[model samples]
Target: MDYIFLNHTADIYICVSGETKERLFANAVLSMYDIMVEGKRRIEDIRKLKVDCINEEDALVDMLNEFLYLFYTCGFVCVECRVKVDEKLDIEASGYYFDKDKDRLKMEIKAATYEYLRIKKDDKWRANIVFDV
Candidate 1:
């Protein structure tokens, strides 16, 4: 599966999988955005964002946090993202302005937490991400 929702008592958890690590990271980002805003919205702007991290899990957290920062501060909602992850995380995302006052939000994701975070790459890449809501 590309991703699946997991039951969390007080927050949110998503399990993501892909044939490669890069695709897995991209899926994780998409899942986070899905929890924030509807996926059907039109994308009007494209932004290039990058992050450097100590490890795979750190890169995932930084990428999601960056999106949250942009949404909370700039009203951008990502529709599509192309992500490349190594020692550095680079993403090119197509996003549209989403006014929280006017748009429908699924939930308020406060942060992407390290608690219960896992990044595993075997035959394929898989990860579990927890978000504080």
Candidate 2:
């Protein structure tokens, strides 16, 4: 569920293993772009958003907002964050490049909320997310 900002050089893979499959946690990541955009809108440009951070719960949110702002201020909507959950169903992700071709960009998510969104002490943020895609 994470996007690697290596253009097409690398692909993003997200694997979730845990007892909790929640969508709210997932939407929190998705909200990144949406919040900055102030709504669901797309951008008509090509750009890359590279992000690096010490992923704590609050840090994660800040990092995510930064990534989303890249497009929000630039007026781009062709962006999505990649978050991969581990066996414990914890969330771990990286930044990705925004892909936009035409003026029209589309973002669809089904689950707007979830029951789980927390980071465990074990490693990798330890989070879970579920969304309607």
Candidate 3:
């Protein structure tokens, strides 16, 4: 796993890292989904996402909230993604719709928050994200 769960009293906190920024964003998405559901998802559907943000941290949070919107409103559970980070963030995501019979709901994430959110680069890109539950 590219992400690890952290201690948070009120919401979900995670430290996600990758060799590159695109990989960092992708891992963040997967980590969010990992917190919410426990099941295997097939790549039966695809969704493209775009987010315009002032900076990388905003981009990350907005992109995550977009995925959360899709999950709550359309039942899309992204299992894999291809991300491009530039003037704008673009993502091509693939996954199946959430199936009650095949998937278990582990938790509900209302949104990704800016509080305690940070993205940094050392030997690798890393992000600390907080989800509002």
Candidate 1: residue 85 lDDT (0-100): 77
User: 1-133, model 1: which lDDT tens digit per residue?
Assistant: 2788889898888888888888888888778888887645777899999899678888899899999999889888887888887678889989789975668888889999998899998888999888999
Candidates' TM-scores?
A: 0.91, 0.32, 0.96
- lDDT per residue (tens digit) for residues 20-60 in model 2: 32333344455534422233334334444333334444444
Candidate 1 residue pairs in backbone clash: none
> How many clashes does the backbone of model 1 have?
0
Instruction: Encode model 3's per-residue lDDT on 1-86: one tens digit a residue.
Output: 79988998988888999999999999999888888999866688989989995699989989999999999988899899889999
Candidate 3 off by > 4 Å: none
Which candidate has the top score in TM-score? 3
Q: 28 in model 1: Cα distance from truth in Å?
A: 0.9
